[model samples]
Target: MRRFKLGLAAVLSLLLVLLAGCQAIGGVDVSKAVLGTLDVKSSMSKQTLSLQLVPADGKLKEEDRKAIEILNSLSVTIDQAILQDSKHMSMEGAVQFSGKKLPFHVAIDPKTMKLFVEGMTQPASVPLDMQELDMAFAGTKMTDETIMESYKDIFGFLLKHAPNPSSISVTPVTDTVNGESLSLQKLHIDIRGDELADLAKGFLTSLSKDQEGMKELIGRLYDTYYPIFAAYAGTSEDGKNALSKADKEKQINEAVKELTSMLNELLPDYDKNVKELLADSPELKDILSKNTVLSLDLMLDSKLKIRKQIMDLTVQLPATEDLPIKQVKVRSETEMWKINEPVTVHDVDSSKGVWDVTPGEGSPGAMLRHVDRQSELYRLLKDDLKITHKSFTLYSDEDPSILYDAGYEPVIVKGTLMVPVKYVADQLDADLKWDKATKQMTLTDDLTGSKIVLKMGSKEASIDGVAQTLSQPVQSFEGYAYVPMKFITKALGAEGYWDAKELVLTIERN
Candidate 1:
């Protein structure tokens, strides 16, 4: 369901694209008006979320009951958010857990786009350069207006092939927001999570067939990054670049062609991939398509601004032997006020102390910098969680402060993931032993006692005593073994996604 969950998120873009200043079903021209209001100068809003679980057959397993109990005790409120534009936004919120309201203040500095946080377990302020964070993988910075305008066509193309794109309904309505009665246009969507089976396969097939659209999109996107690419060449301290502007343009074109060619090579197997995915998890389609409903409602004011928003999802698990949980209801609502009015985001007083994290071994260490050793927040992240930054590094998840950065990062060789053998073993809490005389290494999972044995310079390995073929052989450098990360993670029942741009692998524990 993780793949489905991620792909389903694309519906958000479809929501934005549908409002690209177009006519509605009732001949209403509200889409244009609403789209105009997205690029707001200043605004403030409040949001809240609540979750509830429904048991199946009035019975719940111990773990399911515990999850529901925790959900019942937890609450969160987005007190308010202020922004002077897309770049400058600040939020204050509180999470009520264990009968404690843990207040936190977060702000995005307009000047540097750095994120500042405070009031959790740490008494001092924490500042992080968000742009440098690996999670910010989007190409270049663009405002809401720029994005919606530029990608409208691409969004339309994807939605055209998705199942029941017209399921979204628009209605004229008057809604009260923040104690103000106002005329509004409501855009609402109700979709079953499983209905997306066709969408997944259809999107891949449609895109592969539409060479013109793909080429146009690729060209348009590369062109949009012209400035970003040019800036790299222009900002060299030596005042001379290895690649000139013309060379950069040529490189961009070549990259686009290469990427397009790669896709072309793979597009032919879309059907095969889809069939395999379905065959691997045949129950996935039934569980989601029949038992999950995702709904979103947007209330827009006359100026095309969304004054109120609501999203609700209900997921009902089938009577599967493994998954004991039954149903989950998640709802979120936000009401807006002070639209376009002059406002200033809340700022933190850095006079006390500020932990500014850099990109290195010490990065996540700052999260626990000012944390009280005995505090709940400290215990939660440091002890309760197997903390690891995706496409980056992992820290010790034990009590006395978690693992440190591996010093070296993971690399992708010929499409296979290779990481420091010790890092993966430690993060997965597996025991690792190297046999010098035999030129072999063995990893035994702590929980299941499963074993994965790899021999040096061999394209073969044994998982749980079962032999398997590897994409590449185990390699060692400077006394450290570089093992196939995919093999280790999968063998240990883990999952990971690698960020090629940063040369980091995110091997997540299942």
Candidate 2:
């Protein structure tokens, strides 16, 4: 049951993220145009979100209690904020829980990219690399014009397939704030019952009818959006138009291969669950296909910049013999202010002093001085980490060379490489204790005493006594434990990626 919920949540979350990504990119130009700047100040914004599970039968299960608690804790208020541009943003906000307000202030500048703790004698900052945040679109070639055009096509495709909205209305209003007269526009939108499902079906049906057309549209979007991301990755950091055609193709191909490999590895589990679900009952599919509605109320300034948005959505999930779930309702609202003015800080120059931008760790900078390109760690992939499908054996420059000396060669599993757990444990100086009776191995960081326990053939692990479900379980070969190289390394505080252009797995521990 937990797995079912998790799977559904994962699928829904992925869909939401995808939709949000498209909307965010599509709306950026509109925001910039309407606001005259990409930055807006919100001095007072309030939000509330609530969710209720109306079961077909009476009462709720214990497991459902957690969901209700989470839904109840959704009240928040942003008292003030300032951001002249993306390069500088700050906010003071609080989360309201049980009549108590937990306050927080966040200031982010691209230079420091760290959130500074305020009202303290000495300001402290967390290590966050803001510069690298834009890597999502690093390889794109999108211009304002093309981005808008793409958004139009996307929205057209969606609206054409889905049922038309039940109602949409716009009105104008005027108000004065802080001695400034403001003109605002209000928008109301509502869509009801099974409309979204029909729209989704329409989208899928369209893709089936013109797969090539869908591919072309996606390809164009990819080409436009990925260049900046690739540039941030140092793959094409030059002033040239972007990565060369060959390099771009290489990167794209590498990304596809990596994705395909990962999917293949997870496909079996997904396939089994899907088959079981379909065979057991058709009710789940019916629940998804049933009618649903969403209502939105929005306020915008004269420039068509959004100042507030409220949403109410309800899904009627018909109950079945096996599952008694009936319906779900969600409501949320957000309000903001000072939308017409540019955010500015007069106390200090944001581009100087603590706000001055700094390169991320391992990046060449004034403080770090230089990035050792020739270092063993940097050369882990025999070139830049951007290279595709290029294989280079791992070696540690540390005094003991625990990883390299372990003579652990990568093992191919599910079309991906697995590395010895001993290498990773030793690299972190985590002590490995074996319990033969339980067939479990416990890894404890010698310095921190943080423990992670793994049992052979089990996809579940325990990290610091909390259960963690793994995408892949621990396996054994020749009496040594092996795990997914990327997962194990990441657990040990390392980062890994498949370099664009190929299926090469590059793990870097810094």
Candidate 3:
């Protein structure tokens, strides 16, 4: 899925560049390209992908033809599109497989990055930092120069080396969209399998030239970007600041030297390994030596911008007697446009996460309101538990004033309020340590210097070296080790109250 997204993005970027370049060179207009109605569609066809490519009157030898037959199968398409004056855009896309359809859509404010979905409480505003976003989307150092440099490397290579089709044809046409008839230009391009294979072989051959230059470039890139990458990766070598420039350079040199040495040592066996692999997989060799064809069609407007594109490709799979499936077909289409008015972004309260929960918003009993209201426990405790940032006071529904307090966030599991032992220790100024080998926890109250030990899957605990029985055993679930809220607070010199009428257990500590 990640690769598919990246490939799609590349295709769109290529189209943008092609359109922009054509406009730059000729009578085409791109004044409205800054923002407009846009639509996109894409899909893969399983039927075409599995086709057995064969010519009507040709031999089947692997090397008999310069071009081998590849699958001329699969049928996929993306046809729906609507873009109203820049403020609103709507499109539907789907992929069909095994008689099932996977569909998705996109609708949002392009200017302010406000997202609107069909089934959402409200539109979501997306915030982004320019430098960080550049690094994330472009996959390079957090600088405009580095971002553009990386883009150049990608687009330049693709523009220079991508295979040239065997033929290209253009025609004029007309189509109706949303009841409006518009003149269109259509383009068709054809490519052969042998031409694609030659392109791939040429790419590999070019890598052998300027080995020393490539090595130096790699070392320089590593030395310059490693620290930035490490910061993004959330790793640090020392407690102090990052490495000095000299230190980073030294590390990069060592790494490059090691890599070069390893590659050189393995170079002698490279040809032999390739021969052995081909010898063992004759079908792979045969497939590589075969011929295939790809056809691409594009529909454009008067401005010479693409409105839609269709690709039909065919290739032959290796002959396998055991598999009944052979021929495969694939088809896809995309459309985009510009709107008159841009979608507006509404400002919203950004306060969220840890700071969003006030003194009572996320308290132990407070969260119950958001839980399963149909539960018996919810019915009983709905009005009995008092909520506060520092504690939950039950039965009396009162708050205990404290000088210093840690907070506890409570959750309900199996109709019971489960408190994390760590949250308790944190709120009451305590230290909690775990022993993995014994599956035991040791918690000490910093205020009173009181200590207790609780073991996993055990109902018994030791406090101040004295064994004590608990109402329920300590339990571990979903990577969190927990104990009953009532027991742990009581054992730690805190107060625990139970309201039989309300069916509530509240712990208060200061």
Best by TM-score: 1
lDDT-sorted candidate list, best first:
1, 2, 3
Write down the lDDT of every candidate, Cα atoms only: 0.62, 0.52, 0.47
TM-score of 1: 0.56
**Candidate 1 wrongly placed segments (more than 4 Å):** 1-23, 28-38, 53-64, 110-123, 130-166, 199-215, 230-279, 316-319, 355-510
TM-score of candidate 2 on Cα atoms, chains taken together: 0.45
By lDDT, the better pick of 1 and 2 is 1
Q: CA RMSD for every model?
A: 14.2, 16.9, 17.7
Question: Which RMSD does model 2 reach against the true structure?
Answer: 16.9
State every prediction's TM-score relative to the real structure: 0.56, 0.45, 0.38
Clashing pairs in 1: 21-32, 34-304, 194-289, 395-403, 396-402, 396-403
Which of the numbered candidates is closest to the native, going by highest lDDT? 1
lDDT (tens digit, per residue) of candidate 3 on 1-510:
333234323433343232221121122222222111122122111111222334434334453232223223222333344444233444444433333333424333333333332222233444324444544534434454454455444444333323333365567778643345778766666655434433433332333333554455665566446656666766543425667768766776676576456445434454454456456666545343334445666666775656555666555455665323333334454544442234322233223311122332234433443334553333323432222224554322233221122233344445455466876776655678999999999988554566899998898998899998866677755566667776678766677665545545567753
Of 2 and 3, the candidate ranking higher by TM-score: 2
Q: What C-alpha lDDT, on a 0 to 100 scale, does residue 115 get in candidate 2?
A: 35
